[model samples]
Target: MTTALLLAVVVLGAALQRVSGMGFALVVGPLLVLLVGPVDGVLLVNLCGLLFSLLMLATTRGAVDWRRLALLAPSALVGIVPGALLLAAVSAPVLEIVVGVLVMAGMSAALLARHAPALDGRFAPVVAGAVSGAMSVTAGTSGPALAVYAVASRWDPRSFAATAQPYFVMVAAGSVTVKLLLTDARLPALGAWGYGGIAAGCVVGLFVGRALAGRLSPGRTRAVLVVVAFAGGLATAVRGVASL
Candidate 1:
């Protein structure tokens, strides 16, 4: 049952990610934490997310904005260290609470700041990248920070979507690497068949996303994403408190 649920969550997440260039973690992170334990769940999210992003990047590469990727990728590299350390130090229940709180807070901020004025200058991407990197490593959800940046910078939606893939790739890779090196955390032993299912889920999701691209509006998709994320976060937080 847990494996089945995990596959469903991954499929849903990857589809949403294809549609928005983000939201895989928003949809999958908290729920996975519930299905598995917090640490293994987050590690699985990073690993799966890396694979999904790599696949998406191949299709979106033509539309990518190199300038944005250049600004965001390296700073993200610098920010994962502390995140890995935090993961190492925290207890599972505490980490669950942290994950829940961060997800809720990040999503709220992104929703509220959608109409904010354009944020120009060099520091914007730098800050966003660093925050995103830390969040990605800590919670396996980097979209909110980058979402805020995309809106503030008045980025072209298509380009933002495309550019985000490579950025996600970098952040997820760095996150997994640092976590392995600096922390003792390991992914739950999802065997070859389990991993194969995850990969297939991503592929199916991308196909579904393409099919739905014409019929579904971005607004509706985002609305659903926010709702799912908020619910998952609330549930995880409540579970953490009860456990504590």
Candidate 2:
């Protein structure tokens, strides 16, 4: 039952990511933390997120904004180190609560401020990248920060979506490295079949998302993603409090 649930989560996350270009972690991270412990589940997310981004980049490579990505990557590292330390310092229940709250706050912030002032300044990417990195490490969600940034900067949707893949790759890699160095967090102990299921899920999700690309409305997809993420985050927080 657990394995089936995990696979379902992975598949849904990947499909959303394909449709929205940045929802894999937001949709899946909190739920994974609920199913598994915070450490292992988040670690699994980083690992899988890394691969998911790589797979996405294969098709979206043409639209990447290299200069924006260059600015984002360095600051992301700045945030990652501290985020790793914080993750290492917290207890599992505390981490779960933190992840849940972050998810909720991030989503709320992204959803609420639809018309934020334009942020076309030179330093915007740096700030966005740093926040995204911290969020990625602590909660495995980078989309909300980038989403806000995209809106503020009036980034082109195609470029933003394409650029997000590589950015996610960098964030996931840095997050995993720092966690390994600064904490005892290790990859989840999901066995061979489990790993295989994850791979299959990713593939299936990408395919489904691709098929639905023209048929599914982006606004509708985003609405469903937001609802699921919010509910999952609340449940995770409740579970954390109960455990404590």
Candidate 3:
């Protein structure tokens, strides 16, 4: 039953992610934590996230902005090690609340600043990359940060998705590596089997999202993003209140 639930989360989360280029962790993390323990849930999510990102990397290869990504890669890589260390030290509840508040605030600010000047400065990518790396470790939600940076840069959807894919893949890889180094939790045999199911779901979800993307007018997409962002914030707040 637990495995089935996890699989469902993966399917639904991946569908959301395919449409938005983010939101998988936002949707999946809480439910997975409820089904499994927090630590195991995070580990499993990281593993699946890596796989999903890799798949995106392949599918969107021709569309990525190589120059922009190159500017960010160095700082992102440098930031991940320290980020991993921090994640090892922080409590999950604290991390969740912090992440939740930040996502909500960032998305709200972005929405309000729809007419604001684009962040075209050369240093923007470095700053965004560093923040993304740290957040990925601390909260398991690098999507919001990446979204902010991508939107500011004015990337078309395909370019945005492709450029953001590697960062997520790297973050997941960092999380898994750190977890393996710090803990003795054996990768369950069942988890391996579960991956197949999640992978299948992701493929189907991606196709569905791509097909639906054209039908969603810009206003509709923005509306959905607003709701998802609010939901993410609410989820985090609930966890925080429960912890308190």
Best by TM-score: 3
- Overall local distance difference test of candidate 2: 0.75
**TM-score for each prediction?**
0.83, 0.82, 0.85
Candidate 3 CA-lDDT value? 0.69
Which stretches in model 3 have alpha-carbon errors above 4 Å? 182-193, 217-230
Ten-residue segment with the worst summed lDDT in candidate 3?
Answer: 183-192
Tens digit of lDDT per residue, candidate 1, span 1-244? Answer: 7667767877888888877778787677776667567767787888888999999888889989898788899988887877677767776557657767866786677667768766788899998888788777766777766766665566766677678889988898898888778876687777886787789889988788657655766566555445655765675567668778
For residues 146-200, what per-residue lDDT tens digits would candidate 2 score against the true structure? 7667755657655776788998998899998888888777877778977887888
Better TM-score candidate (1, 3):
3
Which clashing pairs does model 2 show? none
The sequence of per-residue lDDT tens digits that candidate 3 reaches over residues 74-180 is 77667667766666677667776786787678767766777888778779888778767766666666666667666555556556656667867877787677667
C-alpha positional error of residue 235 in candidate 1 after TM-score superposition, expressed in Å = 6.5
- Stretches of candidate 2 off by over 4 Å are 90-116, 216-244
Give the TM-score ranking, best first: 3, 1, 2
| Model 1 bad stretches (over 4 Å) | 90-116, 216-243
Candidate maximizing lDDT: 1
